[model samples]
Target chain A: MSSTLLNQVAFYLLSAIAILGALGVVFLKSPVRAALALVANFFTLGLIYFMLGNQMIGISQIMVYAGAIMVLFLFVIMILKDQTPEEDKSLFQDRRFIFGLLSAIVICGLIWALVINPTMQSFGGEMDRSYGSPQAIGRSFFTTYVWPFEIISILLLVGIVGSIMLAKRKF
Target chain B: MNTFLNLPLAGAVYEDIPLGHFLTLSLAMFALGSIGVLIRKNPVIVFMCIELMLNAVNLSFLAFAAYPNSHVQANNAFESAMAGQAMVIVVMAIAAAEVAVGLGIIMAIFRYRNNVDVDDMNTMRG
Candidate 1:
């Protein structure tokens, strides 16, 4: 089979898995179930990244989000240990649900506009291919995008300090 | 192999997959994630939804990185690929930090309240 056909097949198949898993994340009431669905969604997203030829991003997607972060989420939920004996029945029809539904619709419409708008269509075609490789990315990071790179490092440092502060009982 | 047989008709039009397709899928995922954030009362699920949205944005950024239009004049493939990949790496790093801090807050809240219900956060209101 031609390479084009291979990519197409891969994209749609993976998209199905992703969309369904995302739906599961929203619909499942149990935090554990939702977290599990999210793991599936992250894996499907990794496949999409792979198809886009950002192999490194795909690897990171799996390792960081699916493997580490999500497991952390699950562990926390488990430790929370069902504190409420009443099952929180009102959770089903709360005000947050209605508001969330509205926000979702608005977000979806806006995204569709950005994606399908004729003006965006005129922006041009495929990007330069060097964007896919490791060496090129490293050069760009140290050069034209150096400021943002440093800023992100600072952000991570702040996050580390902030979380420690927040988690500390007397800080 | 008729790989296109499994794909939608739009897949057949391009010799290689287009960045637009990735963007659209990413957007779809983002919207779903947005819904998840708004709809879920559980703080942990809300955090998961936020992560999903971040990943969606990352996908689009990677798409642009992999297929830059700037090199249309010279058709220089290597430079565009490198630029895109570089941006994705940076974004991933930022995302990791956000998750760490964000989840840490959730853990602290759970410790104090013994409840993860996001709606209960309204105590700050006057």
Candidate 2:
């Protein structure tokens, strides 16, 4: 078969895996198990990006998210050295569980409706073109979005400082 | 009955799945993550759910970048796709910083309270 057909198959498969992983992350009780599930989800998402032709994003998602962020999570988990605590009874006191269930049902219903009826094809019907390159992203970041780029750097700086302060003992 | 049963297999070759498929997948993932955030009590699990939501948004943006029909139809595909990618870049940066800060807070709270339950933080509710 042609390469495009290959891409479609890959996309469907990866998307399925990613969604399942996300579901696992949500449903799992142990934080460590949930974190592992998140890693799987990230890997599947990276594969999806690869199928979409954004090789750079695919790689970054794996390297940054699965590698760096997850390691950070595991490090914190280890330092805390806490096994799964008793499930917090106070958690079920509120109507949050009911709310969450309702929200999920409503959202799923909306998605099913949209998928079946599909009146508005708002996003993707253009001719196939290569919008998948690092240079393109770089140029745009340096150009119109330059201010926001600088702002994001500042935000990072603040986040780092804040995290350090919070983690440190004042005495 | 024959063609109906064989339809998916038949047109699987020519039928290029569009951005909508990816968007729907992303939405479903995001919803799962949202439920985790709402339902789960563990701090780390909550944070993981947040990350999942971020990934879902990133996926949607990437799909739009890949198929910039809106931009292409308007004769500005290159610039529009770049715009979408730039947004994702910024989002990833912010998400990274948020994770760091969030974990730090969790660490401090754990040190002080010996637990990270969100409901347990209701100290001011006299």
- Each model's DockQ? 0.41, 0.37
Which regions of candidate 2 deviate over 4 angstroms? A88-95, A111-128, B1-15, B70-74
Evaluating just chain A, the predictions reach TM-scores of 0.80, 0.81
- Superposed Cα deviation of residue A27, candidate 2 (Å): 1.2
Give the poorly placed runs of model 1, Cα more than 4 Å off.
A84-99, A117-128, B1-14, B70-87
Q: By summed lDDT, which 10 consecutive residues of candidate 1 chain A come out lowest?
A: A118-127
DockQ of 2: 0.37
Clashing pairs in 2: none
**Which TM-score value belongs to model 1?**
0.82
lDDT by residue (tens digit), candidate 1, A71-109: 888887887768522234675587776787778788777
Q: How would you encode candidate 2's per-residue C-alpha lDDT over A1-171 as one tens digit per residue?
A: 665666577767877788779978977666777788889999988877766667677788899899999989988877766633555566546588779978888987797577523623555554434555677566666888899999999999999998888878652
Instruction: Report residue B43 deviation for candidate 1 (angstroms).
Output: 0.4
